[model samples]
Every structure is written in C-alpha cells, then in structure tokens.
Target: MEEFNGNDQAFTRDSLYGTASEPTYAGVTSFMRRRYSRDLQGVDLVVSGVPFDTATTNRPGTRFGPRAIRTASVTSAWERHYPWEFDPFDHLAVIDYGDCNFDHALPHKIPAAIEAHAEHIVQAGCAMLTLGGDHFISYPLLKAHARKYGALS
Candidate 1:
C-alpha cells in the first residue's frame, strides 16, 4: 500500500503519483481518491465522468453512476488493486478530471460534446478512463481516442 500524510491529499499533492491519505468514509470523492484536476501537464492517465444518459436504451440512471463508483472505490483505493498486488499509483500518474460538460437541451450535440471533451484530454498526452453515461458514449469516446492514437488495431 502507498502512504500519505493526512486527509485531502488531493489538493495538496502536486503529482498524481502517490496514494491518497483520506480514509474510506471521509474527504472529497474522486476516482480512487485521486486528485480532482483539469491540469494534464504531466498526468499519464485521467479518470473522468460522463454523466449523460440520454442515449441509454433502458434505465436512464447512469448519470449518477460515476459518483457512486468513485465513492465505492475509496475502500479499494486504500490497498493494492486486488490480486494484482501492485499499486498502480506507484507507476501511473492519474487524476479525476471531473465530468464532461454539455448542454442537456441540445440532444444532437451531445456526441460532439463528448468527443470534444475526450479529444482535449487525449491531445494533452494523457490517456482517459471514463466512468459512465451509457454504452453509446463509447462510440464518441472511441472516435476521440482514435483521432489521437490513430486507428485501433
């Protein structure tokens, strides 16, 4: 397990390289207790939420999925990620970049919004792990990633 000084390591820490000190039930809720930031300067990977559920075919409650996932991850983040026995934070620089922004009234522009949001992150030389919105959101995300890394093989 990684070590931290106190609560709220998310704000005080300068890099995404260390584990958070916040306890499972307290402090800010970021994915794996990573810092919440938009700065991608030296970040290796970004975890962001896509709270859109408009494209879902069935239940439309995925908009809240990201937050719930982040909250639940607190317990797991305190230790190495399962059987892997290795702390990813020790190698990868990651941060929770918050959620993608879009205007709910403009349904047709949603895909574009998602693509643009992801594109910005990819363009900054950082990989992304999106939380949730709907299965359809992956299509736009793929497009953005492909544009950055080239055709997936």
Candidate 2:
C-alpha cells in the first residue's frame, strides 16, 4: 500500500471520503482518524461520545472510554477494516463530533442533553455510532434516533 501524507487528516482533510495519511503515533486522535468536525455538511456518519458515567454503579471509567477508543482506532486507520475487502471510508464521510456537553452537576438534565446531541447529528443527515457512557444513555439515544427515524419497532 502507498503511504499517505496528510497529517492530522481528522482536522485537515477537505473531502468527506478518502483515508488519512497521518502516522499512527502522531497528530490529534479522532475516530478512525477521520475529521473532527460538527459541520456535518457532507458527513455520512458521526461518531459522538456521551461521556456521562453518573449512572454507573460498579464502574465509573466509561467517561474516559470514548477517548481511549479513538486512540486505539489510530492503529487501524491506515487500512481497510479487517475481514472486509473494502475500506468504509472510501464510501462514507465520517467524523468525530466530539463529546456531548452537559452540566454534570445537574443529573436531571443529562438525558435531554444526550437526546439533543444525538438529534443534531440525525438532523444533519448523518447516522451516529456513539461510544458508550453508561447503559442509561441508551434510553436517551434510542429516543433521539427513534424520534428522527421513527419507532424502534
């Protein structure tokens, strides 16, 4: 495979497609080294994080999982996803939309925040693959996705 030269493709690339050229150990980390943007203009997918672990009981480290996942993703961005003959990025425009913002001090508002965050992506004509924060997040995520696309059934 030929080497790519676009360092920090996550933030530098102009197109919605094509692979990043950055070295695995360098540059800012984004999902699959995709662009870091909320613009969603031609974006086909948004990888956003909830990062809310307040609902967890036994473990509370989920808030850090999104970043860890993004970091780990660096190693695999250089090639097509395993077991597949094609590169997903060659056809899809994906981005790391960053984390959902909410006032953690106010637990009651978290669900709405999550829903609104998801709503923005859906409204932008992009599908989302959210990193887990806590199981409770699913409740809001489901509601958000359903509201945009219809009933889960």
Each prediction's total of clashing residue pairs, residues at least 3 apart in sequence or on different chains, is: 0, 1
Summarize candidate 2's per-residue lDDT along 103-138 as a digit string, tens digits.
Answer: 989999999999999998897789999987888899
How high is the CA lDDT of each candidate model? Answer: 0.85, 0.85
The residue pairs found clashing in candidate 1 are none
Show model 2 residue runs off by greater than 4 Å.
1-3
Lowest-scoring 10 consecutive residues by lDDT in candidate 1? 1-10
Weakest 10 consecutive residues of candidate 2 by summed lDDT: 1-10
- Which regions of candidate 1 deviate over 4 angstroms? 1-3
Q: Estimate each model's TM-score.
A: 0.91, 0.93
Residue 69 of model 2 has an lDDT of 91
